[model samples]
Target: MDYNEDTATDAVLASFEETTDPRLRAFLRLLVPHLHDLVFEFRPTLAEWEYAIEFLTRIGQKCDDTRQEFVLLSDVLGVSMLTETINGQQEGTESTVLGPFHMVASPQRKNGESIDLLGGARPCVIDATVLSTDGKPLVDAEVDVWQCTEDGFYDVQQPGIQPPGNGRGLFRTGEGGRFWFRTVVPSHYPIPQDGPVGELLKATGRHPYRPAHVHFIAKAEGHRALTTHLFVAGSPYIDSDAVFAVRKSLLTDFTESRDEDLARQYGVTVPFVLATPRIVIEPEEGDGSG
Candidate 1:
């Protein structure tokens, strides 16, 4: 068949007929039609297409060992959160985007250990409990935690200023499924915007700020792992997250406590912020709870 506008989608899809993977073949078939429709509906000249290709290339070029502009692209487009939501827990802590800054492995830490390598005004204690959907304590759960500092910059973002693993930690739930950490309350900050994604946001007049939150990934045997955030109550941009990852259930109160005894107990000083959040883990499929 001669390649023509009428037969373009069919021709392109047929070219993938020999694909060995059934799922991939099906996806290409679905993708081609939409692509063809886009082209037909709003036809672009060759120069326009070249600029589009270059735009995509720059998105890839912006990535590196510690930076991911493509993930940022998905985040700004709302695709990351949509995909996570599609595969997310239906009955427990709702999952959010694994923001690009989780670039490196968190340093392993013991319960009640501090993750704050830098000092800030709002010293905080994250006293958390991991439990099953049935309210049973989930012991030995691997809880990987990370967040920006009080200044709104991650360790990865500030190479020399912040030490490695400054605001990151890998902890395990211990007795009563408890895991605690000491850190400063994070500040709301803008997503990295010195790349092509930034250009797009500026052209669209959108701000790139996210609300103050601590990232957490909880994993326990025989249960589905959860990726979520503990959003500080009343944080700026809570209603307008740049990545659209916020959920009301994830809002946590960063209450202040002036009790010196509580401070000494958590190994911090008085007037520290306290956040107690319960993370309920959902069981894996066919784990008898499903």
Candidate 2:
């Protein structure tokens, strides 16, 4: 077979025609033509192709145990959100990107405990509940939460400054499917912009900021695990999120309260903020009965 632009795609796809996995074979068959079409249309010079390769190489090299450059790339390109939207749960809380900062494990803490290790910032209480779509409480549910510091950096992002688990906690829902935690209000922050993804954003005139939000991964024995964000209402970039992840349903108000009694209940001082969000979980497919 002659290897010309017109024949190249079919020839390459033919090589993968024998892929054992049905899904992989179908994906390759669908992907090759479009990829080849782009290559043919762009007609990059050898130097430009080399640069593209180098760019991807740097993206891989920038990844570490704490940072995921590929996910960051996918996020900035809106690919992550698109994929999530396509395969997300139909009922319950709306889903969003998990972001690149969830690389570390959350330390388990008791209900009503505080995840704010540094303290000294304006505190906020998160009173959350996990329930089934039918409003039944999901007992023993695990809710993993994490967020950036008041200064807009995760503990992993500022190693020496922020203590480990400074803004992270894993709590189990108690009676009535309730869990609460104390932490400082999170500030809007930029995604890591010191690597290849940053360079791409700069070149494209795109910002790297995400709005203030706390990430949650809620799971139970029979329910489908949910990964979502609770965006602070009125936060910067809510409308023009850098990663296009802001969903109106997930925007939650952080109300100010000077009630000393409520503050003491959550172990925070007065003049604090309160965020009360309810999470609904859907049962996994084939949840019961064989």
Candidate 3:
């Protein structure tokens, strides 16, 4: 039982063969070989291994109630987007990363209400509909939405300056599965670059900017929930999103509208951007709506 590069992985994997959970056993069986293969392929100096351990340690230390360094790590590495792609609904709006900012609960608000607490920024009205894949409107669907401010910082990112839920809302679809809300057009901003992930990005000469987008998590009683984004079309970094979460279908135009009547309807001043995004959910199994 001499430990060699090829046998090392097998020995470690065999140790997990007795795991009770089949999924866990399978994952370990697969992960161990690949990880060992990586180690075997690129043998590192003791100092390098120590530095790697310290890097991962710092990544864990950087996480908190409000910030998730692991999610950021997955995002910057494109793992989050890949996971979403693999598990996403087949016939709905394309899924994207549920960025770290969704750590808090969204405050419930009425339809057409404004999520923006600090006013005076340019307004954008989001008129959205939640429907089944068959085009049937889903009544009373919950839509949780959040975005950064016009200054490109989320409420959580600037706790002292931005009130809680400054750019977040939980609304339900009204009749015809419609929901609308008012908020400032979010600005393209860099991801938090104050931690290990930031250091990694800098070491790799990669930028940390993501395109302007609004996140949505739509759920209905009998339908599969959808977590996705409405990316601002033509926004900076749209084509080069640092997280690699952009899908062409999710890119939407926030058209400029100066209609006073439309402004009054949404309770916003004139010259606001109007966005209309439709979300489609699939019926869950055994829901009897299929």
Q: If scored against the real structure, what TM-score would every candidate get?
A: 0.98, 0.97, 0.97
Query: Sorted by lDDT, highest first, which candidate order results?
Result: 1, 3, 2
Model 3, TM vs. native: 0.97
Q: Estimate every model's Cα lDDT from 0 to 1.
A: 0.94, 0.91, 0.92
Per-residue alpha-carbon lDDT of model 1 for 1-290, expressed as tens digits?
Answer: 79998788888988999999999988998999998999998899999999999999999999998899999999999999999999999898889999999999999999988899977777899999999998999999999999999999999999999999999999999999999999999999999889999999999999999999999999999999899999999999999999999999999999999999999999999889999999998999899996
lDDT of each residue in 1-290, candidate 2, tens digit only: 78997789879988997899999998999999888888889999999999999999999999998989999999999999999898788888988899999999999999988898998469899999999877999999999999998899999998999889889999999999999988989999999999999999999998889999999999998888899999999999998888889999999999999998987777777899999999998888896522
TM-score of 1: 0.98
Off by over 4 Å in 3: 287-290
Q: How accurate is candidate 3 locally (lDDT)?
A: 0.92
For model 2, name the residue pairs that clash.
none
Model 1 alpha-carbon drift over 4 Å, by segment: none
Worst 10 residues of 2 by lDDT: 281-290
Q: Report the Cα lDDT for residue 122, model 3.
A: 89
* Model 1, CA-based lDDT: 0.94
